[model samples]
Target: MKKLIGIDLGGTTIKFAILTENGEVQQKWSIETDISNNGRNIVPNIIESIKYHLEIYGLSREDIIGIGMGSPGSVDLENGTVIGAYNLNWESLQPVKEQIENGTGIPFFIDNDANVASLGEQWIGAGKGSNNVVFVTLGTGVGGGIIAEGKLVHGVGAAGEIGHINVDPNGYTCTCGNIGCLETVASATGIVRLARDMSEQYAGESKLKYLIDDGQQVTAKIVMDQAKENDPLAIKVLDKFNFYLGLACGNIANVLHPETIVLGGGVSAAGQILINGVDHYFQKYTFPQIRNSTKIKFAELGNDAGIIGAASLVKRQS
Candidate 1:
Protein backbone atom coordinates (compact mmCIF):
# COMPACT_ATOMS: atom_id res chain seq x y z
CA MET A 1 0.00 0.00 0.00
CA LYS A 2 1.24 3.46 -0.82
CA LYS A 3 1.89 5.84 2.11
CA LEU A 4 1.35 9.58 2.50
CA ILE A 5 2.62 12.18 4.94
CA GLY A 6 0.44 14.96 6.34
CA ILE A 7 1.44 18.06 8.25
CA ASP A 8 -0.83 20.47 10.11
CA LEU A 9 1.25 23.53 10.94
CA GLY A 10 0.03 25.87 13.64
CA GLY A 11 1.52 28.63 15.76
CA THR A 12 1.88 26.45 18.84
CA THR A 13 2.52 22.98 17.44
CA ILE A 14 3.06 21.11 14.21
CA LYS A 15 1.08 17.86 13.98
CA PHE A 16 2.58 15.17 11.76
CA ALA A 17 0.89 12.04 10.56
CA ILE A 18 1.71 9.07 8.38
CA LEU A 19 -1.29 7.67 6.63
CA THR A 20 -2.35 5.13 4.07
CA GLU A 21 -3.39 6.41 0.66
CA ASN A 22 -6.95 5.94 1.91
CA GLY A 23 -6.52 8.59 4.68
CA GLU A 24 -6.30 6.22 7.64
CA VAL A 25 -3.74 7.59 10.06
CA GLN A 26 -1.03 5.01 10.79
CA GLN A 27 1.07 7.07 13.13
CA LYS A 28 0.91 10.62 14.45
CA TRP A 29 3.18 12.93 16.40
CA SER A 30 3.76 16.59 17.06
CA ILE A 31 6.51 19.12 17.68
CA GLU A 32 6.50 22.58 19.20
CA THR A 33 6.63 25.43 16.70
CA ASP A 34 9.89 27.35 16.73
CA ILE A 35 9.07 30.98 16.10
CA SER A 36 12.42 32.40 17.14
CA ASN A 37 14.54 34.25 14.55
CA ASN A 38 11.56 35.31 12.45
CA GLY A 39 10.50 31.68 11.98
CA ARG A 40 13.62 30.81 9.97
CA ASN A 41 13.80 27.53 11.91
CA ILE A 42 10.25 26.42 11.18
CA VAL A 43 10.75 24.68 7.85
CA PRO A 44 14.09 23.18 8.83
CA ASN A 45 12.53 21.74 11.95
CA ILE A 46 9.77 20.13 9.94
CA ILE A 47 12.30 18.62 7.54
CA GLU A 48 14.40 17.16 10.32
CA SER A 49 11.38 15.75 12.12
CA ILE A 50 10.14 13.96 9.03
CA LYS A 51 13.56 12.51 8.46
CA TYR A 52 13.79 11.30 12.03
CA HIS A 53 10.35 9.68 11.97
CA LEU A 54 11.04 7.95 8.65
CA GLU A 55 14.21 6.39 10.03
CA ILE A 56 12.53 5.26 13.24
CA TYR A 57 9.71 3.58 11.33
CA GLY A 58 12.26 1.84 9.06
CA LEU A 59 10.79 3.42 5.99
CA SER A 60 12.73 4.71 3.01
CA ARG A 61 12.04 7.97 1.22
CA GLU A 62 10.64 6.00 -1.74
CA ASP A 63 7.96 4.44 0.48
CA ILE A 64 6.08 7.71 0.77
CA ILE A 65 4.15 8.73 -2.34
CA GLY A 66 3.57 12.36 -1.45
CA ILE A 67 3.37 14.92 1.34
CA GLY A 68 0.65 17.48 2.03
CA MET A 69 0.73 20.40 4.44
CA GLY A 70 -1.67 22.95 5.95
CA SER A 71 -0.23 26.29 6.95
CA PRO A 72 -1.64 29.38 8.67
CA GLY A 73 -1.43 32.24 6.16
CA SER A 74 -2.32 33.33 2.70
CA VAL A 75 -0.92 30.64 0.42
CA ASP A 76 0.03 31.46 -3.15
CA LEU A 77 -1.28 28.24 -4.67
CA GLU A 78 0.71 28.54 -7.86
CA ASN A 79 3.97 29.18 -6.00
CA GLY A 80 3.26 27.45 -2.65
CA THR A 81 4.49 30.46 -0.72
CA VAL A 82 2.87 31.55 2.53
CA ILE A 83 2.39 35.30 2.77
CA GLY A 84 2.46 37.30 6.01
CA ALA A 85 1.46 34.80 8.72
CA TYR A 86 1.58 37.06 11.76
CA ASN A 87 1.22 34.20 14.23
CA LEU A 88 4.12 32.35 12.68
CA ASN A 89 6.08 35.60 12.62
CA TRP A 90 6.45 35.24 8.87
CA GLU A 91 6.34 38.84 7.69
CA SER A 92 7.46 37.89 4.16
CA LEU A 93 6.60 35.19 1.70
CA GLN A 94 8.09 31.84 2.67
CA PRO A 95 8.72 29.28 -0.08
CA VAL A 96 7.35 26.39 1.98
CA LYS A 97 6.78 24.10 -0.96
CA GLU A 98 10.27 24.40 -2.42
CA GLN A 99 11.95 24.01 0.94
CA ILE A 100 9.93 20.99 2.03
CA GLU A 101 10.16 19.28 -1.37
CA ASN A 102 13.90 19.81 -1.47
CA GLY A 103 14.37 18.48 2.03
CA THR A 104 12.11 15.42 1.56
CA GLY A 105 12.46 14.59 -2.18
CA ILE A 106 8.70 13.99 -2.21
CA PRO A 107 5.86 15.54 -4.14
CA PHE A 108 4.30 18.14 -1.86
CA PHE A 109 1.17 20.31 -1.76
CA ILE A 110 -0.11 23.00 0.59
CA ASP A 111 -3.16 25.08 1.44
CA ASN A 112 -4.53 27.27 4.19
CA ASP A 113 -4.99 25.30 7.42
CA ALA A 114 -8.69 26.06 7.72
CA ASN A 115 -9.21 25.15 4.09
CA VAL A 116 -7.59 21.77 4.58
CA ALA A 117 -9.56 21.11 7.76
CA SER A 118 -12.75 21.81 5.86
CA LEU A 119 -11.64 19.42 3.17
CA GLY A 120 -10.93 16.80 5.80
CA GLU A 121 -14.37 17.07 7.33
CA GLN A 122 -16.02 16.98 3.94
CA TRP A 123 -14.06 13.94 2.88
CA ILE A 124 -14.82 11.76 5.90
CA GLY A 125 -16.48 13.56 8.77
CA ALA A 126 -19.73 15.48 9.27
CA GLY A 127 -19.92 16.59 5.61
CA LYS A 128 -19.06 13.23 4.16
CA GLY A 129 -21.00 12.14 1.06
CA SER A 130 -21.74 15.77 0.26
CA ASN A 131 -20.14 17.61 -2.60
CA ASN A 132 -20.81 21.02 -1.10
CA VAL A 133 -19.92 21.97 2.45
CA VAL A 134 -19.04 25.01 4.54
CA PHE A 135 -16.99 24.67 7.74
CA VAL A 136 -16.87 27.37 10.41
CA THR A 137 -14.38 27.42 13.28
CA LEU A 138 -15.15 29.51 16.38
CA GLY A 139 -12.04 29.89 18.50
CA THR A 140 -10.00 32.85 19.71
CA GLY A 141 -11.10 34.20 16.36
CA VAL A 142 -13.39 32.82 13.71
CA GLY A 143 -12.18 30.99 10.59
CA GLY A 144 -13.94 29.12 7.80
CA GLY A 145 -13.55 27.00 4.70
CA ILE A 146 -15.92 26.37 1.84
CA ILE A 147 -15.96 23.34 -0.42
CA ALA A 148 -18.30 23.42 -3.37
CA GLU A 149 -18.78 20.44 -5.65
CA GLY A 150 -15.87 18.67 -3.97
CA LYS A 151 -13.40 21.49 -4.57
CA LEU A 152 -12.17 24.27 -2.30
CA VAL A 153 -13.51 27.70 -3.15
CA HIS A 154 -10.39 29.88 -3.08
CA GLY A 155 -11.74 33.12 -4.43
CA VAL A 156 -8.77 35.48 -4.59
CA GLY A 157 -7.17 33.35 -1.81
CA ALA A 158 -9.77 34.33 0.80
CA ALA A 159 -13.04 32.83 -0.32
CA GLY A 160 -14.08 30.89 2.78
CA GLU A 161 -13.65 33.58 5.40
CA ILE A 162 -17.01 33.05 7.09
CA GLY A 163 -15.86 34.96 10.15
CA HIS A 164 -15.51 38.21 8.27
CA ILE A 165 -19.07 38.19 7.05
CA ASN A 166 -20.62 41.48 8.10
CA VAL A 167 -23.41 40.71 10.53
CA ASP A 168 -23.67 44.03 12.41
CA PRO A 169 -23.13 47.52 11.05
CA ASN A 170 -22.62 49.24 14.42
CA GLY A 171 -21.12 46.34 16.40
CA TYR A 172 -17.56 46.01 17.68
CA THR A 173 -14.62 46.32 15.30
CA CYS A 174 -12.95 43.03 14.43
CA THR A 175 -9.24 42.29 14.27
CA CYS A 176 -9.64 42.51 10.49
CA GLY A 177 -10.56 46.21 10.85
CA ASN A 178 -14.16 45.52 9.96
CA ILE A 179 -17.21 46.43 12.02
CA GLY A 180 -19.62 43.73 13.16
CA CYS A 181 -17.89 40.79 11.52
CA LEU A 182 -19.08 37.44 12.92
CA GLU A 183 -15.77 37.02 14.73
CA THR A 184 -16.44 40.04 16.95
CA VAL A 185 -19.47 38.43 18.55
CA ALA A 186 -19.35 34.73 17.79
CA SER A 187 -15.82 33.72 18.70
CA ALA A 188 -14.62 32.74 22.20
CA THR A 189 -13.20 36.21 22.75
CA GLY A 190 -16.32 37.66 21.22
CA ILE A 191 -18.55 35.72 23.63
CA VAL A 192 -16.58 36.90 26.63
CA ARG A 193 -16.63 40.46 25.41
CA LEU A 194 -20.38 40.37 25.05
CA ALA A 195 -20.82 38.85 28.48
CA ARG A 196 -18.64 41.49 30.10
CA ASP A 197 -20.38 44.38 28.41
CA MET A 198 -23.85 43.02 29.10
CA SER A 199 -23.04 42.20 32.72
CA GLU A 200 -22.14 45.82 33.43
CA GLN A 201 -25.44 47.07 32.11
CA TYR A 202 -27.59 44.24 33.41
CA ALA A 203 -29.23 44.68 36.85
CA GLY A 204 -30.62 41.17 36.79
CA GLU A 205 -29.19 38.59 39.15
CA SER A 206 -27.01 36.01 37.33
CA LYS A 207 -23.96 33.87 37.93
CA LEU A 208 -22.01 35.79 35.28
CA LYS A 209 -22.70 39.04 37.11
CA TYR A 210 -21.43 37.58 40.37
CA LEU A 211 -18.35 36.16 38.67
CA ILE A 212 -17.56 39.51 37.16
CA ASP A 213 -18.17 41.30 40.44
CA ASP A 214 -15.70 38.93 42.10
CA GLY A 215 -13.08 39.84 39.43
CA GLN A 216 -12.86 36.39 37.91
CA GLN A 217 -11.88 35.93 34.30
CA VAL A 218 -14.95 35.05 32.27
CA THR A 219 -14.56 32.64 29.37
CA ALA A 220 -16.86 31.43 26.63
CA LYS A 221 -17.14 28.14 28.51
CA ILE A 222 -18.09 29.96 31.67
CA VAL A 223 -20.75 31.89 29.86
CA MET A 224 -22.15 28.75 28.28
CA ASP A 225 -22.13 26.99 31.62
CA GLN A 226 -23.92 29.86 33.26
CA ALA A 227 -26.45 29.95 30.48
CA LYS A 228 -27.04 26.26 30.95
CA GLU A 229 -27.69 26.94 34.61
CA ASN A 230 -30.31 29.57 33.71
CA ASP A 231 -28.24 32.65 34.36
CA PRO A 232 -30.16 35.45 32.67
CA LEU A 233 -27.12 37.56 31.78
CA ALA A 234 -25.16 34.65 30.26
CA ILE A 235 -28.20 33.54 28.32
CA LYS A 236 -28.52 37.04 26.94
CA VAL A 237 -24.91 36.98 25.80
CA LEU A 238 -25.37 33.59 24.19
CA ASP A 239 -28.53 34.75 22.50
CA LYS A 240 -26.62 37.60 20.90
CA PHE A 241 -23.88 35.26 19.77
CA ASN A 242 -26.28 32.74 18.29
CA PHE A 243 -28.24 35.48 16.58
CA TYR A 244 -25.16 36.69 14.69
CA LEU A 245 -23.80 33.21 14.08
CA GLY A 246 -27.08 31.86 12.79
CA LEU A 247 -27.46 34.99 10.70
CA ALA A 248 -24.06 34.51 9.13
CA CYS A 249 -24.62 30.86 8.38
CA GLY A 250 -28.07 31.62 7.04
CA ASN A 251 -26.70 34.16 4.58
CA ILE A 252 -23.93 31.77 3.55
CA ALA A 253 -26.42 28.99 2.95
CA ASN A 254 -28.56 31.30 0.93
CA VAL A 255 -25.62 31.95 -1.37
CA LEU A 256 -23.97 28.49 -1.56
CA HIS A 257 -26.77 26.12 -0.60
CA PRO A 258 -24.31 23.63 0.74
CA GLU A 259 -25.37 20.24 2.07
CA THR A 260 -23.88 20.80 5.47
CA ILE A 261 -22.37 23.64 7.50
CA VAL A 262 -19.98 21.94 9.93
CA LEU A 263 -19.09 23.86 13.08
CA GLY A 264 -15.77 23.27 14.87
CA GLY A 265 -13.13 24.95 17.10
CA GLY A 266 -12.87 25.59 20.83
CA VAL A 267 -16.12 27.45 21.26
CA SER A 268 -17.88 24.73 19.32
CA ALA A 269 -16.93 22.43 22.19
CA ALA A 270 -19.92 23.96 23.93
CA GLY A 271 -21.63 21.20 21.98
CA GLN A 272 -25.42 20.96 22.16
CA ILE A 273 -25.98 24.40 23.65
CA LEU A 274 -24.00 26.08 20.91
CA ILE A 275 -25.64 24.12 18.09
CA ASN A 276 -29.15 24.44 19.50
CA GLY A 277 -28.84 28.18 19.91
CA VAL A 278 -27.41 28.68 16.44
CA ASP A 279 -29.95 26.35 14.88
CA HIS A 280 -32.83 28.39 16.26
CA TYR A 281 -31.68 31.53 14.49
CA PHE A 282 -30.47 29.58 11.49
CA GLN A 283 -33.98 28.25 10.99
CA LYS A 284 -35.31 31.76 11.27
CA TYR A 285 -32.91 33.45 8.82
CA THR A 286 -32.17 30.98 6.01
CA PHE A 287 -34.14 30.95 2.79
CA PRO A 288 -37.24 28.82 2.96
CA GLN A 289 -36.03 26.18 0.51
CA ILE A 290 -32.49 26.20 1.86
CA ARG A 291 -33.70 25.60 5.40
CA ASN A 292 -35.04 22.26 4.31
CA SER A 293 -31.80 21.09 2.68
CA THR A 294 -28.86 22.71 4.44
CA LYS A 295 -28.03 21.12 7.80
CA ILE A 296 -25.72 22.42 10.51
CA LYS A 297 -23.73 19.94 12.63
CA PHE A 298 -20.54 19.52 14.64
CA ALA A 299 -17.33 18.38 12.98
CA GLU A 300 -16.43 14.76 13.75
CA LEU A 301 -12.75 14.66 12.86
CA GLY A 302 -11.71 17.13 15.56
CA ASN A 303 -7.95 17.85 15.69
CA ASP A 304 -7.13 15.21 13.09
CA ALA A 305 -9.06 17.05 10.41
CA GLY A 306 -6.11 19.17 9.35
CA ILE A 307 -3.75 16.21 8.89
CA ILE A 308 -6.27 14.16 6.95
CA GLY A 309 -7.23 17.14 4.84
CA ALA A 310 -3.60 17.84 4.05
CA ALA A 311 -3.16 14.27 2.85
CA SER A 312 -6.24 14.69 0.67
CA LEU A 313 -4.39 17.43 -1.20
CA VAL A 314 -1.84 14.86 -2.35
CA LYS A 315 -4.61 12.39 -3.09
CA ARG A 316 -6.34 14.90 -5.32
CA GLN A 317 -3.21 15.36 -7.41
CA SER A 318 -2.40 11.69 -7.58
Candidate 2:
Protein backbone atom coordinates (compact mmCIF):
# COMPACT_ATOMS: atom_id res chain seq x y z
CA MET A 1 0.00 0.00 0.00
CA LYS A 2 1.28 3.45 -0.83
CA LYS A 3 1.79 5.70 2.18
CA LEU A 4 2.24 9.48 2.56
CA ILE A 5 3.76 11.81 5.12
CA GLY A 6 2.28 15.08 6.28
CA ILE A 7 3.94 17.82 8.25
CA ASP A 8 2.32 20.78 9.98
CA LEU A 9 4.73 23.46 11.11
CA GLY A 10 3.75 25.97 13.75
CA GLY A 11 5.61 28.51 15.83
CA THR A 12 5.85 26.33 18.91
CA THR A 13 5.24 22.78 17.73
CA ILE A 14 5.82 20.68 14.62
CA LYS A 15 3.31 17.89 14.06
CA PHE A 16 3.85 15.10 11.54
CA ALA A 17 1.99 12.00 10.53
CA ILE A 18 2.07 9.00 8.24
CA LEU A 19 -1.15 8.10 6.56
CA THR A 20 -2.75 5.91 3.95
CA GLU A 21 -4.35 7.29 0.79
CA ASN A 22 -7.73 7.47 2.50
CA GLY A 23 -6.53 9.81 5.30
CA GLU A 24 -6.17 7.31 8.13
CA VAL A 25 -3.26 8.31 10.34
CA GLN A 26 -1.04 5.27 10.57
CA GLN A 27 1.49 6.97 12.84
CA LYS A 28 2.06 10.40 14.30
CA TRP A 29 4.67 12.34 16.24
CA SER A 30 5.55 15.87 17.24
CA ILE A 31 8.50 17.97 18.34
CA GLU A 32 9.03 21.38 19.87
CA THR A 33 9.73 24.03 17.23
CA ASP A 34 12.40 25.68 19.40
CA ILE A 35 12.26 29.01 17.60
CA SER A 36 13.60 30.75 20.73
CA ASN A 37 17.25 30.30 19.87
CA ASN A 38 17.20 30.84 16.12
CA GLY A 39 14.77 30.07 13.33
CA ARG A 40 17.52 28.80 11.05
CA ASN A 41 17.54 25.39 12.71
CA ILE A 42 13.96 24.56 11.76
CA VAL A 43 14.70 22.88 8.44
CA PRO A 44 17.32 20.62 9.96
CA ASN A 45 14.99 19.71 12.79
CA ILE A 46 12.24 18.85 10.34
CA ILE A 47 14.53 16.68 8.26
CA GLU A 48 15.66 14.83 11.37
CA SER A 49 12.09 14.23 12.43
CA ILE A 50 11.25 12.76 9.06
CA LYS A 51 14.25 10.46 9.31
CA TYR A 52 13.23 9.44 12.81
CA HIS A 53 9.71 8.57 11.70
CA LEU A 54 10.93 6.53 8.75
CA GLU A 55 13.42 4.67 10.95
CA ILE A 56 10.85 3.92 13.61
CA TYR A 57 8.37 2.60 11.12
CA GLY A 58 11.07 0.63 9.30
CA LEU A 59 9.64 1.86 6.03
CA SER A 60 11.77 2.13 2.93
CA ARG A 61 11.61 5.03 0.51
CA GLU A 62 9.51 2.96 -1.91
CA ASP A 63 6.73 2.62 0.67
CA ILE A 64 6.23 6.38 0.78
CA ILE A 65 4.59 7.94 -2.24
CA GLY A 66 5.08 11.62 -1.34
CA ILE A 67 5.35 14.18 1.43
CA GLY A 68 3.35 17.35 2.05
CA MET A 69 3.75 20.20 4.52
CA GLY A 70 1.43 22.88 5.79
CA SER A 71 3.67 25.73 6.78
CA PRO A 72 2.71 28.80 8.82
CA GLY A 73 3.70 31.47 6.33
CA SER A 74 3.16 32.92 2.89
CA VAL A 75 4.18 30.25 0.42
CA ASP A 76 4.64 30.26 -3.34
CA LEU A 77 3.20 26.85 -3.99
CA GLU A 78 4.04 26.78 -7.67
CA ASN A 79 7.70 27.46 -6.97
CA GLY A 80 7.88 25.85 -3.53
CA THR A 81 9.24 28.98 -1.89
CA VAL A 82 8.25 30.26 1.52
CA ILE A 83 8.18 33.96 0.81
CA GLY A 84 7.70 34.95 4.40
CA ALA A 85 6.77 33.23 7.64
CA TYR A 86 6.35 35.89 10.31
CA ASN A 87 6.10 33.40 13.14
CA LEU A 88 8.99 31.35 11.77
CA ASN A 89 11.11 34.45 11.13
CA TRP A 90 11.88 33.10 7.68
CA GLU A 91 12.30 35.23 4.58
CA SER A 92 12.52 34.19 0.95
CA LEU A 93 13.51 30.60 1.55
CA GLN A 94 13.68 29.30 -1.97
CA PRO A 95 12.87 25.83 -3.26
CA VAL A 96 11.69 24.31 0.03
CA LYS A 97 10.50 21.31 -1.96
CA GLU A 98 13.95 20.67 -3.42
CA GLN A 99 15.60 21.13 -0.03
CA ILE A 100 13.30 18.66 1.70
CA GLU A 101 13.63 16.19 -1.14
CA ASN A 102 17.39 16.37 -0.94
CA GLY A 103 17.23 15.66 2.77
CA THR A 104 14.67 12.83 2.71
CA GLY A 105 14.82 11.61 -0.90
CA ILE A 106 11.05 12.09 -1.06
CA PRO A 107 9.15 14.52 -3.28
CA PHE A 108 7.45 17.18 -1.17
CA PHE A 109 4.83 19.89 -1.59
CA ILE A 110 3.85 22.84 0.59
CA ASP A 111 1.08 25.37 1.10
CA ASN A 112 -0.36 27.69 3.74
CA ASP A 113 -1.42 25.75 6.81
CA ALA A 114 -4.88 27.31 6.87
CA ASN A 115 -5.58 26.43 3.24
CA VAL A 116 -4.36 22.89 3.73
CA ALA A 117 -6.59 22.57 6.78
CA SER A 118 -9.67 23.50 4.78
CA LEU A 119 -8.71 20.99 2.13
CA GLY A 120 -8.31 18.33 4.83
CA GLU A 121 -11.79 19.04 6.18
CA GLN A 122 -13.23 18.79 2.71
CA TRP A 123 -11.56 15.48 2.06
CA ILE A 124 -12.25 13.56 5.28
CA GLY A 125 -13.56 15.85 8.00
CA ALA A 126 -16.61 18.02 8.48
CA GLY A 127 -16.46 19.37 4.93
CA LYS A 128 -16.80 15.96 3.35
CA GLY A 129 -19.37 15.94 0.55
CA SER A 130 -19.38 19.72 0.32
CA ASN A 131 -18.02 21.26 -2.84
CA ASN A 132 -17.89 24.79 -1.51
CA VAL A 133 -16.94 25.65 2.05
CA VAL A 134 -15.21 28.31 4.10
CA PHE A 135 -13.06 27.41 7.11
CA VAL A 136 -12.23 29.87 9.86
CA THR A 137 -9.90 28.99 12.70
CA LEU A 138 -10.23 31.21 15.80
CA GLY A 139 -7.08 30.50 17.72
CA THR A 140 -4.52 32.85 19.28
CA GLY A 141 -5.10 34.56 15.97
CA VAL A 142 -7.81 34.02 13.38
CA GLY A 143 -6.98 32.32 10.08
CA GLY A 144 -9.20 31.36 7.16
CA GLY A 145 -9.25 29.33 3.94
CA ILE A 146 -11.64 29.46 1.04
CA ILE A 147 -12.62 26.51 -1.14
CA ALA A 148 -14.88 27.23 -4.08
CA GLU A 149 -15.86 24.88 -6.89
CA GLY A 150 -13.78 22.12 -5.34
CA LYS A 151 -10.56 24.11 -5.68
CA LEU A 152 -8.42 25.91 -3.11
CA VAL A 153 -8.24 29.59 -3.96
CA HIS A 154 -4.69 30.90 -3.84
CA GLY A 155 -4.67 34.45 -4.99
CA VAL A 156 -1.39 36.30 -4.48
CA GLY A 157 0.10 33.99 -1.89
CA ALA A 158 -2.92 32.74 0.00
CA ALA A 159 -4.76 36.03 -0.24
CA GLY A 160 -7.92 34.60 1.32
CA GLU A 161 -6.75 36.07 4.60
CA ILE A 162 -10.22 36.46 6.04
CA GLY A 163 -8.85 37.28 9.47
CA HIS A 164 -7.12 40.40 8.25
CA ILE A 165 -10.26 41.79 6.65
CA ASN A 166 -11.18 45.01 8.38
CA VAL A 167 -14.21 44.25 10.49
CA ASP A 168 -13.92 47.23 12.85
CA PRO A 169 -12.52 50.46 11.53
CA ASN A 170 -12.05 51.65 15.11
CA GLY A 171 -11.04 48.42 16.77
CA TYR A 172 -7.74 47.32 18.25
CA THR A 173 -4.54 47.03 16.22
CA CYS A 174 -3.58 43.70 14.68
CA THR A 175 -0.14 42.11 14.43
CA CYS A 176 -0.32 42.66 10.68
CA GLY A 177 -0.19 46.40 11.33
CA ASN A 178 -3.86 46.91 10.68
CA ILE A 179 -6.52 48.40 12.90
CA GLY A 180 -9.79 46.61 13.55
CA CYS A 181 -8.95 43.49 11.60
CA LEU A 182 -11.26 40.58 12.35
CA GLU A 183 -8.46 38.80 14.19
CA THR A 184 -8.01 41.74 16.52
CA VAL A 185 -11.47 41.26 17.98
CA ALA A 186 -12.62 37.78 17.06
CA SER A 187 -9.67 35.47 17.72
CA ALA A 188 -9.01 33.49 20.93
CA THR A 189 -6.46 36.05 22.07
CA GLY A 190 -8.85 38.76 21.02
CA ILE A 191 -11.55 37.27 23.23
CA VAL A 192 -9.12 37.21 26.16
CA ARG A 193 -8.14 40.79 25.47
CA LEU A 194 -11.74 41.85 25.32
CA ALA A 195 -12.49 39.98 28.54
CA ARG A 196 -9.56 41.69 30.26
CA ASP A 197 -10.74 45.09 29.15
CA MET A 198 -14.26 44.36 30.37
CA SER A 199 -12.99 42.90 33.64
CA GLU A 200 -11.14 46.12 34.29
CA GLN A 201 -14.08 48.30 33.34
CA TYR A 202 -16.59 46.27 35.34
CA ALA A 203 -14.57 45.40 38.42
CA GLY A 204 -17.39 45.27 40.85
CA GLU A 205 -17.89 41.50 41.47
CA SER A 206 -17.77 39.55 38.26
CA LYS A 207 -16.52 35.98 37.93
CA LEU A 208 -14.10 37.10 35.20
CA LYS A 209 -12.54 39.54 37.63
CA TYR A 210 -12.00 36.72 40.10
CA LEU A 211 -10.26 34.67 37.43
CA ILE A 212 -7.79 37.45 36.82
CA ASP A 213 -6.92 39.48 39.88
CA ASP A 214 -4.97 42.06 37.92
CA GLY A 215 -6.14 41.03 34.45
CA GLN A 216 -2.79 39.45 33.57
CA GLN A 217 -3.72 35.86 32.57
CA VAL A 218 -7.13 35.90 30.98
CA THR A 219 -7.89 33.14 28.48
CA ALA A 220 -10.78 32.38 26.12
CA LYS A 221 -11.57 29.22 28.04
CA ILE A 222 -11.84 31.11 31.29
CA VAL A 223 -14.17 33.64 29.74
CA MET A 224 -16.29 30.85 28.25
CA ASP A 225 -16.46 29.08 31.60
CA GLN A 226 -17.67 32.24 33.29
CA ALA A 227 -20.25 32.81 30.59
CA LYS A 228 -21.42 29.21 30.77
CA GLU A 229 -21.99 29.80 34.51
CA ASN A 230 -24.25 32.76 33.59
CA ASP A 231 -21.93 35.59 34.57
CA PRO A 232 -23.38 38.79 33.15
CA LEU A 233 -20.02 40.34 32.32
CA ALA A 234 -18.77 37.18 30.61
CA ILE A 235 -21.97 36.93 28.61
CA LYS A 236 -21.48 40.50 27.52
CA VAL A 237 -18.01 39.67 26.27
CA LEU A 238 -19.35 36.72 24.29
CA ASP A 239 -22.14 38.89 22.99
CA LYS A 240 -19.68 41.37 21.60
CA PHE A 241 -17.53 38.61 20.12
CA ASN A 242 -20.51 36.96 18.49
CA PHE A 243 -21.76 40.24 17.14
CA TYR A 244 -18.51 40.84 15.32
CA LEU A 245 -18.28 37.20 14.28
CA GLY A 246 -21.75 37.46 12.83
CA LEU A 247 -20.83 40.57 10.94
CA ALA A 248 -17.80 38.88 9.51
CA CYS A 249 -19.74 35.78 8.58
CA GLY A 250 -22.38 37.95 7.00
CA ASN A 251 -19.72 39.56 4.85
CA ILE A 252 -18.34 36.16 3.86
CA ALA A 253 -21.78 34.84 3.07
CA ASN A 254 -22.52 37.80 0.91
CA VAL A 255 -19.46 37.16 -1.20
CA LEU A 256 -19.00 33.38 -1.29
CA HIS A 257 -22.44 32.04 -0.43
CA PRO A 258 -20.67 28.95 0.75
CA GLU A 259 -22.67 25.86 1.56
CA THR A 260 -21.08 25.59 4.99
CA ILE A 261 -18.82 27.64 7.21
CA VAL A 262 -16.53 25.51 9.38
CA LEU A 263 -15.20 26.95 12.65
CA GLY A 264 -12.13 25.47 14.31
CA GLY A 265 -9.36 26.27 16.83
CA GLY A 266 -9.27 26.39 20.63
CA VAL A 267 -12.03 28.95 21.02
CA SER A 268 -14.36 26.72 19.00
CA ALA A 269 -14.10 24.18 21.83
CA ALA A 270 -16.64 26.33 23.69
CA GLY A 271 -19.05 24.08 21.77
CA GLN A 272 -22.65 25.21 21.65
CA ILE A 273 -21.92 28.39 23.54
CA LEU A 274 -19.81 29.81 20.73
CA ILE A 275 -22.06 28.34 18.05
CA ASN A 276 -25.25 29.61 19.62
CA GLY A 277 -23.78 33.04 20.10
CA VAL A 278 -22.59 33.28 16.51
CA ASP A 279 -25.80 31.78 15.17
CA HIS A 280 -27.95 34.24 17.11
CA TYR A 281 -26.10 37.25 15.75
CA PHE A 282 -25.66 35.77 12.30
CA GLN A 283 -29.43 35.47 12.04
CA LYS A 284 -29.84 39.05 13.14
CA TYR A 285 -27.09 40.51 10.92
CA THR A 286 -26.94 38.48 7.73
CA PHE A 287 -29.12 38.95 4.62
CA PRO A 288 -32.43 37.33 5.41
CA GLN A 289 -32.62 35.39 2.15
CA ILE A 290 -29.11 33.92 2.34
CA ARG A 291 -28.95 33.30 6.09
CA ASN A 292 -31.12 30.20 5.84
CA SER A 293 -28.91 28.77 3.09
CA THR A 294 -25.52 29.14 4.75
CA LYS A 295 -24.97 26.62 7.52
CA ILE A 296 -22.29 27.25 10.15
CA LYS A 297 -20.72 24.17 11.73
CA PHE A 298 -17.75 23.42 13.96
CA ALA A 299 -14.71 21.74 12.42
CA GLU A 300 -14.20 18.16 13.55
CA LEU A 301 -10.53 17.62 12.68
CA GLY A 302 -9.06 19.73 15.50
CA ASN A 303 -5.24 19.89 15.56
CA ASP A 304 -4.92 16.89 13.30
CA ALA A 305 -6.61 18.73 10.47
CA GLY A 306 -3.46 20.34 9.15
CA ILE A 307 -1.43 17.14 8.90
CA ILE A 308 -4.30 15.18 7.51
CA GLY A 309 -4.95 17.89 5.00
CA ALA A 310 -1.30 18.21 4.08
CA ALA A 311 -1.02 14.49 3.54
CA SER A 312 -4.09 14.61 1.38
CA LEU A 313 -2.45 17.18 -0.86
CA VAL A 314 -0.35 14.42 -2.37
CA LYS A 315 -3.47 12.94 -3.85
CA ARG A 316 -4.51 16.23 -5.34
CA GLN A 317 -1.12 16.64 -6.94
CA SER A 318 -1.06 13.09 -8.25
How do the residues 40-62 of candidate 1 rate in per-residue lDDT, one tens digit apiece? 99999999999999999999889
Clashing pairs for model 2 are: none
- Highest-TM-score candidate: 1
Estimate every model's Cα lDDT from 0 to 1. 0.93, 0.86
- TM-scores, all models, native as reference: 0.97, 0.91
Consecutive 10-residue window with the lowest summed lDDT within model 1: 155-164
lDDT per residue, candidate 2, 1-318, as tens digits? 999999999988999999998999999999989775447778888898899879889998788989999997778787777857878877657567878889999888888999999988888888888888899999888888999988888876556788998888989999999899989888888998888777778856787877776646778888898899999889999999998888898788888888888999888999998898898877876787879888899998988999999998888885
Count of clashes in candidate 2: 0
Candidate 2 stretches greater than 4 Å from native = 34-38, 92-94, 199-205, 210-216
Weakest 10 consecutive residues of candidate 2 by summed lDDT: 34-43
Q: Roughly what TM-score does model 1 have, to 2 decimal places?
A: 0.97
